[model samples]
Target: MLQVEHLHKSFADFKAVAGADLTVRQGDLVAVIGPNGAGKTTLFNLITGHLTPDRGRILFKDVDVTGLPAHEICRKGIARSFQIANIFPRLSVFRNVQVSVLSQKKLSHTLFRPAQTLVVEETNRILDSVGLSDKKLDIAGSLSHGDKRVLEIAIALGNEPELLILDEPTAGMSPDETTTTMDLVKRLATEQGLTILFCEHDMDVVFNVATSIMVMQHGQTIIQGRPQEVRQNVTVQEAYLGGA
Candidate 1:
């Protein structure tokens, strides 16, 4: 559960997030949608501690977390994947996930015992959930773009997140790959009871997977509602959704 109240952030006269507020309840698969320069990513940065808000508050589970460091927020059960695939290029898929698992446990790999061996089963389970089990031994950099994205998600799941923030999860992918990724995300929300908040440009993905949608424009959240409501709203249509 997360609550953002009157959040604002700016960079030298350009307001990236202007008085935005929203609440994400447990088990929500919420989508944040908007056009370019809409401040979607900036809002995520504020919540995740990449950028401290200039004003307002970000609360998770009744505790105020505004201005907490990114690592601290992550340890508090928030995890994210970036717009670009953030993977360890040289690490094997299994090892990449093992790093996250070990990081979550506050242990670093040393020559004495490889972290991968210690968390092999759990790491493999994450890989399997993301449908990358077969690529476990493959180098992360060598995988296709879609697979790389999946790997990044596997790493996020390693943190055992209560809320997963995915920035452009399907930014570049074939339709099939996109569908696979959406299905995997939906399954995680359903089976694992994970809460999700994602910023996405793909309307199809947004409409299909999101239980609720928030439309942002000019650095502010202008509309927040269910999929059908967002689709038919005249203001949202003109502002962002491009409805007919």
Candidate 2:
């Protein structure tokens, strides 16, 4: 569903992503794993239009979308969740999701209508999918960290994206919460048929859930293969395991 060809991005003298090429097929759960400064997030920024690539092409479906604006890319059916919780702190969970739903529909100007009443059913469905239905009326800032992350996922879901780009979805959660988040992501791909491309530091999470894994080091992909194949790769072992 997504194709990145010979992608390169640089900041000043430093190259962050160097000729990175990747393809994510429909309904595939692909994980990009790398250490700090490996350029995983930079690749994501390039694809999502947060940063223009110094070189290369980004194709979604079959159309080239190299330098499209973030919102335009999102409208083209790609949605991203940040490593941090990017929630509207003061907005109720329902309203937060409602805003996304409105944004997706280009109805942001419908301010006079009650957002809750306008998108209540769809918002509730998203909340249930993310296991946050009971917290629909709660303030976003007041939820626990794990719930906040789930809220971020819910917000991403609001766009009904064909491809979801998640940066560190299980970043700071406890063991149980991480497991729950992993389960949610698996269901997103398996049941909902959403294509997932994520960057994660948690090896166990990557190994357990990823259909394929790409290992990056020094701003380049060192290995791309199935979980077991990547696990046994010599360079991966030398760079990630030996270092760990």
Query: Of the candidates shown, which would achieve the greatest lDDT relative to the real structure?
Result: 1
Write out the backbone clash pairs for model 2. Answer: none
Q: What residue runs in model 2 are displaced by over 4 Å at the alpha carbon?
A: 108-118
Summarize candidate 1's per-residue lDDT along 9-38 as a digit string, tens digits. Answer: 999999989988878999999999989988
Name the runs in model 1 displaced over 4 angstroms. 110-118
* RMSD each, Å: 1.7, 1.9
User: How much is the lDDT of residue 56 in candidate 1?
Assistant: 95
169, model 1: CA deviation in Å?
0.3
Cα lDDT listed for each candidate = 0.91, 0.89
